[model samples]
Target: MSIYIDPAVALSLRGYEMPERLGFGTAMAPVMFRAVCQDGCWSNGELIPYEPLSVDPAAKVLHYAQSCFEGMKAYRTGEGIALFRPEKNAERMAYSAKRLCMPPVPESLFLDGVRTVAAYCANLVPGNSGESLYLRPFLIGTQADLTVSASTSYEFYVIASPSEAYHSGNMRLWVEREDARAAVGGTGDAKVGGNYAGSLLSIGRLKERGYDQSLWLNPADRSSVDELSGMNFFAVIDGALHTPALNGSILEGITRFSLIDLARNLGYKVVEGTIHIDELLGQVASGTCTEAFACGTAAIISPISVIGDDGGSYKLSQVPGPVAQHLRQALLDIQEGRVEDHFNWMLSVETVEV
Candidate 1:
């Protein structure tokens, strides 16, 4: 189906000004891609002037929290503008929708929506290293009903923002023992709004304690480390890489798996298994674990400087270790087109005649 572009989109794109500081998600594109699904049938997408949404006060998404979102990026590559692992984001969005009992946006439609936005807003793709046009694709149940059932109608939107890396320098994390962000056998693994909503209080409390983010443990046992509020956790023990194994509560981050593959390819021993919180702390204190970091699409790789708890603060021997630095540069090289994309992860988007 052909995508329709509103005539006003051109005017909006022409009149927009680039922000001096393109911090994460602050500089939104002037045009947006949108499509509606009614009774399980998806409509043709349209590119309209970016404006405020008209969500009903009693919509299911407003009351029941029936929404899912994906975070992906478009980069200025050797082949012009391109997207990084968009297919992975599409597949993950489908998984999140199914877990929420909402109708999944067809994969073809999902791709078309993102591509249309990126193609038209190609000029928004930043030229700085580690900067790109961040794309946010979301689905919401739109039926205005007060009942506790899935809405029959849904709205899908693709929006773009020219942004730099989310979290740049080393970070301090708090060991959260009292609040559980996600529970086992729940929507922990799914990329939904509710999962993130449940984590706000923990992050809020952690900030008061002089911590940057929360290190959440497994809700079932409350002993093994699961993940951070929005990113996956990783540690460098001795000379190898260790991360928590998938236990249905940790969102399988695209950047996390890509780093695992990129690390193994670069001759590093990467292990995915359960990491006990107390034991890991002891290892950090004893200098057995030298470095740690968190990974996600927005914050590619942020080194962990300290892990604080009721006991005390444990400082990493190296704020940014050799291994973390090496991997981060290697991944950025592939993303920014400094080197060949041996992994074939980028999907090039044609620049539209805007």
Candidate 2:
């Protein structure tokens, strides 16, 4: 389906200036892509000026938390603007919407929303390494009713940001023992707002203690490693890569999945299994676990420096170990067009003329 470009969208794009400080996801693009749905029928998407949404006070999303979102990037690759594994994000967003009882944006519509935004905002795709156009595609229940049920109306919007790499540095993590980010059979696996809103308390508490993130344990057992608050976790033990196996509660990240495949191709022994927190800490102490890191779309891969709990802090011997450095460089090389895309991951977008 052809995307409609509003006249105001061209003006917004032409008048806007790229900020000198391109902090990650802070500087928004002047134009956005939007599509609406009512009674399970979706409208054609539009490229329009980015503006504040006039949501009703009694909207279902405002009260019942009926919202979901996906994060992906548009890169300045060898073949112009490209999106990395966007289909995975589209699939995940569909799952998230279904979990919240919201109408899933059709894959075609999802691709149109992202591709149109990326194509129009092609000039805003930063040229620097570790920088790209960060695309945030979200869905919200728009029906203005206070009743505790799914809304008949929904709005989907895709906004872009010219961003530098999200740099968390070598992170310090706090083991969250008191609070759980998501429940066993709840919306834990979904990429919904409530899951993140529920985690802010734990993040704030950990930040007070000088930790950068929370290493969340499994909600059911609370003994095995699950993931970080926003990113997936990985640890290298005895020269092997180990990430927690995806259960019902873990949000499967696209970056994590890509790295697993990339690491295996690089001849690393990749293991996806239940990683017990106690055993992991013990391995860290014994020098078997030499390095650890977290992966996500925003941060890419951030090395973990320390893990602190009520017991004590366990520091990984290597801050940014060889495995992490190798994987990060390999992934970035593919993303930035520095090397061949052997896995056929990137989908190039033609720049749309104003």
Candidate 3:
């Protein structure tokens, strides 16, 4: 299907100015790609000027929270411009939609939506080393009736933001024990908006406590580390890479998977299994766990300096350990096209002529 580009999109691009500081998903691009689905068939996509969406007051999404989204990036590469592991995001988005009982966005449509947006906004992609165009693809239930059922009509959109690395410095994490973000068999593993909404209060309370993020534990046990609100958790324990296993409750982050493979290739022992919360805290307190960090498409890798719980606070011996630094740079090198992509992860985008 052909993509329609509204004339206003061109005008907005011509008149737009990028801000000097892009602190991760703050400054949105002026154009957007949209497509709709009805009765299980998807319509042709269109590129138009960015604006607020119009929805009925009783739409199912407003009540049932039936929405899913993906975060990926477009980087300036040796081949002009490329996306890092976009297929992974597409696959994950489909999984999220299915878990929410929404129609899955076919992989082809997902790629077309993101590539169309990125090709047109190539000039808006930041040139800085840790900066690029962050792409957000989302699907929502639009049916007007709000009777606690999945919407028959759905909408898919790809919006973009010019962004730099998410966090500027080492992070402080608050260990949440009182409230559970996701259940064992719930939407915790899915990239749905409701899971994020449930985490906002934890993040809000921690922000006042001088913490940068919340390290959520598994919902079933509440004794094993799951992940952060928007990222996956990792730690360097005893000269090995330790990350939570892909439990049903942990969102399988693209960056987290890639780093595991990257670290293993770099002669590091990477382990993915259950990590007891108390045992991890004990290790951190005893200098057995030297470093802890989080990764996602938004924040590549953010070092965690402290983990605070009701019992007490434990500090990592190295906020940004040598292992994290090495892996981060290695991953960045592959992402920014500074090094060879031996894993065939980067997909080059053909600039579409308007």
lDDT of each: 0.93, 0.94, 0.91
TM-score of 1: 0.99
TM-score of each: 0.99, 0.98, 0.98
Backbone Cα, N, C clashes tallied per candidate: 0, 0, 0
Residues 228-267, candidate 2, lDDT per residue (tens digit)? 8889999999999999999988899999999999999999
Residue pair clashes in candidate 2: none
lDDT of 2 at 80: 93
List of clashing residue pairs for candidate 1: none
Candidate 3: residue 134 Cα off by (Å): 0.4
Write the residue-wise lDDT of candidate 3 on 272-316 in tens digits.
999999999999999999999999888899888999988888999
Better of 2 and 3 by TM-score: 2
Q: Indicate the worst ten consecutive residues by lDDT in candidate 2.
A: 163-172
Task: Report each candidate's C-alpha RMSD, comma-separated, in the order given.
Answer: 0.8, 0.9, 1.1
